[model samples]
Target: MNSAVTSRTLARTDSVRPFKAGAYGFVLLGIGHLALSAAAATATQTSERRAVDTVMRESTFALLGLERTVLDVFNGMSIAMAFFSITCGLLILAAVRHAPALVQRRTAFGWCALAVSLAVLVVSVLLLPPPPIVVLTVTSCAFGLSLRRATTVSAHAAEAA
Candidate 1:
């Protein structure tokens, strides 16, 4: 690309600052979650964890007419959540790169992300340990900052117009 185009691209990328933080937070946390979940699932279990694993593996419940062990259900949920978090991050990155103007204008995408992040943060606080809780806290905060910045820019543009 020409220098002019390259410069414009770099400038555009630079403009949406806080969105980057939130997007990377979601992406990185999802990766960490996936890695930790897989490691914990596979790592040599301690006595207590082994006992719980046995119960989880042995215990069965019917859902949608299918029987599933607690272990199976829990693992499935963990994988699903990892994918969802990664997708949310990718979507935000796409929005930031491909539709910066729309992002600044304040869209449903931003609102949904903020809401989902906060909801996850709350759940993490209640159920998970410090690491996930801290990640969610930062993710939610970055999302909130990005959205608030977008709202301010939109308001200023409106006033100027």
Candidate 2:
């Protein structure tokens, strides 16, 4: 409540804002991805066998080759998305560990990076055409927004100082 203590607290808060936002974003993104993977696995295991059999019976390999190619493209996209998500997660971890200090300095940059990363992730998930991936993308967007808000608050506080 004292001026000195208040100032110190504000300063500290500002310093860690971005890092905390990044961390939260990463955690959310990771959880979303894991959830998506689990759901996809479950759907594939439970519902796809009959459909796959039907497709196999009716479809020739040459025709199926196109399906395979499409799937291959999706697989590559999924892999890339996963990699980017992981990288974002790592950055979040770094931010969390360092907190306000890391956040204060790179708030804008961090936000931009997360926004782009999330955009790419969403596109990748859409390309895969998985319900779970879509869910993950939505959840990740929510988290990313939350982080952005937090960083903004922290930046404002810092500027006030």
Candidate 3:
């Protein structure tokens, strides 16, 4: 290749890799959140089943006054929330991976992911414990900051050249 073309190509590649890495980091973060949510849902479902069984066997409908309807609703809500969290994770991964042109915009995406994760953490505190979600949130934020820094450095280098 000609010198000018070669240099330009190299510059583009240099700018691209960090963004790709950042995108993959988001994917990993999503996967981590999905796994954690699934684990929590399973544990919660199992516990609910046990409670139902205990109530049925012990005939404590009056003492504890736990109704099947209430248990079912709670279980359904938990499962629904888990499903929504998984869907959001998948969507974030897909969005970043499919749109390479948006590499420069990855910082914004990362921030969004981090914000959502924080919101999830707050909700988890009110409802359930989610240490894994917190971990993933921090991880996503780091990747985002890395992407922004790399992009800024590349832009400066390109300007100097």
Best-matching candidate per TM-score: 1
RMSD of 3: 8.5
- Record all residue pairs in model 2 with backbone atoms less than 3 Å apart, i.e. clashing: 15-100, 15-101, 16-99, 16-100
- Tens-digit per-residue lDDT, 28-133, candidate 3: 5456556765676567467667887566555523326654455455555655665665566556556656764444433566556556656655665576546545
Candidate 2 TM-score to native:
0.45
Q: Rate residue 81 of model 2 by lDDT.
A: 61
lDDT of 1: 0.79
Model 1 C-alpha lDDT per residue in residues 82-114, reported as the tens digit of each score: 888888788889878898865565677777877
Determine which window of 10 residues in candidate 3 has minimal summed lDDT. 6-15
TM-score of 1: 0.81
Regions of model 1 farther than 4 Å from truth: 1-15, 152-161
lDDT by residue (tens digit), candidate 2, 77-142: 656665666676677666557564444444564566556656656776656456445545554554
